[model samples]
Target: MIEPELTRCVASFHPGATGVTGAAKLSGGASQETWTFDIVHPSGNVGAILRRAPPGYGAAPGRAAGLDAEATLMQLAHDAGLPSPKVMHVLTPEDGLGRGFIMARVEGETIARKILRDEEFAKARPMLARQLGRVIAGIHGLPQAKLPQLRSLTATKEIEDLAREYQSFNWPRPVFELALRWLRDHDPGPSSEVTLVHGDFRHGNLIIGPDGVRAVLDWELAHTGDPMEDIGWICVNSWRFGEIDKPVGGFGTREDLFAGYAEAGRKVDPDRVMFWEVMGTLRWGVMCCGMMQRFRLGPDHSMERAMIGRRASETEIDLLRLLAPRGK
Candidate 1:
């Protein structure tokens, strides 16, 4: 239960918290816990969400820099002319809710499976892909020097440092080892160019509406890095949801998305994006290994962790197929 003082603190921040009630936990978030609440004011009622990072398997260090920076990055994205919810406030550790923030509950379609299967958004798929490209381009164009908060949170000097960090991890999968070597060797040339990357941007990460995209949600992984990381992360096959042919966020082709990005003043490099996608598969595979790392020895066994262990093989297979062409 939330303390009365903390509740009052939340209420004080927004005038809409007069009779805040029905606060319940939301589902589907594996890393952090999210709660949705109904706030009743004298004028009307409003819906809002709060995200908190609890002690978990994948929690990163840097308290203030974690979710707090996400809030600021979301604000920056909104300022950069992308569709995003308005960030109301960021809470400190003392706030009793753990590391988190409050934001307007954006109403739109965010589920990839639902969007792809639903008849309502059939025609809107292409437009959604185009808008996604444009939004990504906008994020990549942000002034690097202006984003000191993000720079402080990052562990690497460059985006490629992520690959190095991954290499250092004690991984159980051989595919990941091969991928790390490939990434290090390729090196994408040194990029002095840095920009804001929505660490996990994809179909489900975006909220699509009839008019257009309403909000870009989930800034937990926001960071400073090469723009192609964001591009490749989206194109990762895991997000494609079995649709191998449909590359543009599980809807349109990469060609259409690239054209859209080009129109948005961002140059699209197929090879660069492909590299990141490979990294995405490999990195996520490593992450799954980390999830099950505790159980590797024995005694702390979990069925979920074992299931995740099976996922690495498929990702490795995908990476191999992507790199090894017909004649290569």
Candidate 2:
């Protein structure tokens, strides 16, 4: 059924003469879906992925960057010689698949635990921090005028947003309250330079192979903001997934990350990165609570939400370690 539509879609964009096969849903929810398939052609089978809203969801809710913007960002990164998928086609109504785009698939592993412990990625683990640092710099350096309209965020606005979202849950998390007060009292006001911030940059969003980061995926949370925000978010403890000692995604240190960023001719303010790290920690905690609310009250009743929601307490431990560090 969908193959017929996909066949037509690919034929228009790619000079292929045949159809599609092996179309299967990889992951999805109510708002978005990712499907993997092979475009059958006389040359061979070309692996492709479709990220769409399934013909019904009009736009991304809350703070998500719309799919159109995601496609554009990907194309820009690809053009800039950064690690990103090559966008193959942008869907139209006539394509009949929904609102989304097709992109060439990059092969890699996204699981954090496996990337941390597995021998296959052993060589990649150490170099990832620095390599990804350069990648982040490239992302921040993307030409602004060519970019699609995105929400610009500041540290104050981010704190307020997180605070409001947390208070709505009516959950009395003392650690969260402490973090909120600290962020307010030490508010750094506006940043000196605003650039594209990959709002969610972590293990799961990166495609890693033995060589290093093959491609950066999931620009759904991409936005224009303090460039330091991206560095801070990547350093959060929850993303480390147990390798707390290695702060940068459980593989490397802040020093290396900064070094890599500096290699790109960009200066970094260590103090700002530190502040955003704390903010990012508390933000993830609030999001965990939101997951609980969505699971209990929202339409989706999947157990994954409940599982991730239970990890909120771990973030409290991390917050304490960050804000009130003990002499070691």
| Most accurate candidate by lDDT | 2
Q: Estimate each model's TM-score.
A: 0.84, 0.98
Model 2 Cα lDDT, one tens digit per residue, 206-247: 999999999999999999989999999999998898899999
Q: Highest TM-score, which number?
A: 2
lDDT of 1: 0.71
TM-score of model number 1: 0.84
Residue range with the least summed lDDT across 10 consecutive positions in model 2: 53-62
Q: List the residue pairs that clash in candidate 2.
A: none
Off by over 4 Å in 2: none
Q: Model 1: which ten-residue window has the lowest total lDDT?
A: 151-160
